[model samples]
Target: MSSNSSIKCTVKKPVEVKISDTKSSLCSGLSIVDLSFPNNSEKGIQQIESISFKNAYTAFLTIKVKSEQNSSSTGGKWKMCLHRYQLMTSPHYESGSQDYFKIPSSQMLFVPQDVVSVRLILQQPSSAWNQFGIEQVSIETPTENTNEEEAISKWLQQHLNLNSTVKKKIENVEVDEVSGGLHRMWALTETVKAQQTSASLGRYEVDDSYEINLLSYT
Candidate 1:
């Protein structure tokens, strides 16, 4: 893939977020946030690249995903991608509160292909804060262009590896002495020009009047 290409999938706006039941007495407790993707035909099937969100006194987080199955008989099922992941170093304190975090591709248990929905189970044991929940949640998926570029890159790398001897021969070829001498001369001229200082006209007067009070010699 190209270095500049992003693997994150473009999440459509108006993401439906459903919050589960919370404790009435406590300010914050266990809660579930479900994110649904209604339209799959627009961008086609996509895999989960990463998950990102801003922390709002959330101590722990659990991630589950649902993906479309190939078989028509069997429908999509929910699978646990991440379980009881610690979001904050200390829930009681404000160490990880209001901090933005991104769960990288490597950390994910399994990359769910054709993912239709995602569930985030948040837990905040501490009641020190007035409100606690995850904020600004985002789901990233690999782009079609990224996948195509990755395939092309892999093919090119394989071909290059197979033709390593040709590359070595090109690198080993010596430069012509005439061209080398010209390059050296150009470099020398440039170096001399850089080192040369502006010549003084020996005149320190502005309007035929000397402005210096003391003579300076170095």
Candidate 2:
């Protein structure tokens, strides 16, 4: 009997993907953010084992100490717990910062292939005046590279499943980078109709504008 040693996978270049359309409200108690990509045929959402934040900070939004409130007050006891998780992994809490904080790579844990989500849970203590806040937030993950032609082939096969000739024509189309990072790959010949339809259906249009993080892959 043969035993499988491991499942090896390579982390590729980061690609810009739309996670959310707008910024969320500042939630202090418990906030859950969805990190899945939009559902589309041409897109393959990256499976992340780790992530990092550009800036993460927790501080006192406002501190009001009442004369009546003593050292035993409950306000001084609440603290923020920064946690990240996937479906299979346990919540990894970040520590070591009562003020500005950034998670170092050494402290990061593995995120699963399942959708990644983050939560900021509020921990209350025995004293008073313990409100906390987080801001300047950014989320990131490493992505794998994709072959442009393979993407185009898959898109065309969606429509031309019966017409191999048309599929060949579409595949034969060549493009050159004419200006400012735009690849002139669209064909205006008889294949124009096919191109237009494929585009509207969310076919290929390269969007490589995103920050990349070159961390050691696990």
Candidate 3:
């Protein structure tokens, strides 16, 4: 995962739209082409879906918002999306919401595509002049193969560092070979004593005795 880029933003008002990156609008707005305006009352009326690239395996965006103080509408939800599939939904905001939050590919079980594009959909948003700003959009490229097993193994190793720095003597004990469950078990050895004797009191009145021994096991 490498390569990152930010998408250009187009700001819109109730009347028209344009391909401009200047922060002329204070807070909120919708995405649209020039001369096209979306219904402000409608939820998610604007969608930025044209940030296309090659070999993008993961994508994320930065959002900036101005919290509502005494406004009629509370801050609304927005989506970090791939096509129409959303990878994340922003939490409701009442005050200013500005941060660089990451939207990873794993959220939507996203697989790398040769031609990949990400879209940000704003739903029930307040005016762009007052509410939110789309900051930075980025996508990551897959340099290596990715799989569920490999991802899970990597996550477990990162969080559970049982054998990270130092090697343990009792490791990878196959507790259940049939089920393929692994654990750590002690490698123990012990010794035991055993004796055997025999005596006869008949005939020649002779007695014989023998000693037996047992060895360590497991």
TM-score, one value per model:
0.53, 0.25, 0.27
Clashes of each: 1, 13, 6
- Which stretches in model 2 have alpha-carbon errors above 4 Å? 1-45, 49-99, 104-109, 124-130, 144-218
- Candidate lDDT scores, in order, read 0.70, 0.33, 0.33
lDDT of 2 by residue, 51-77 (tens): 333212221111111111221364423
Write down the RMSD of candidate 3 (Cα, Å): 18.3
Per-residue error (Å), model 3, residue 114: 1.7
What local lDDT score does residue 162 receive in model 2, on the 0 to 100 scale?
83
Candidate 2 vs candidate 3, TM-score winner: 3
Which 10 consecutive residues of model 1 have the lowest summed lDDT? 2-11
Give a tens-digit lDDT track for model 3, residues 53-149: 2211112222222112212253432222234332224223332244344544554433223221223444223332333333444433334446677
Write the residue-wise lDDT of candidate 1 on 188-212 in tens digits.
9999999988965446655556656
Q: Evaluate model 2: give its lDDT.
A: 0.33
Ranking by lDDT: 1, 3, 2
Residue 190, model 3: lDDT of: 19
On a 0 to 1 TM-score scale, where does candidate 1 land against the true structure? 0.53
| Model 1 regions lying over 4 Å from their true place | 2-28, 41-45, 70-76, 144-218
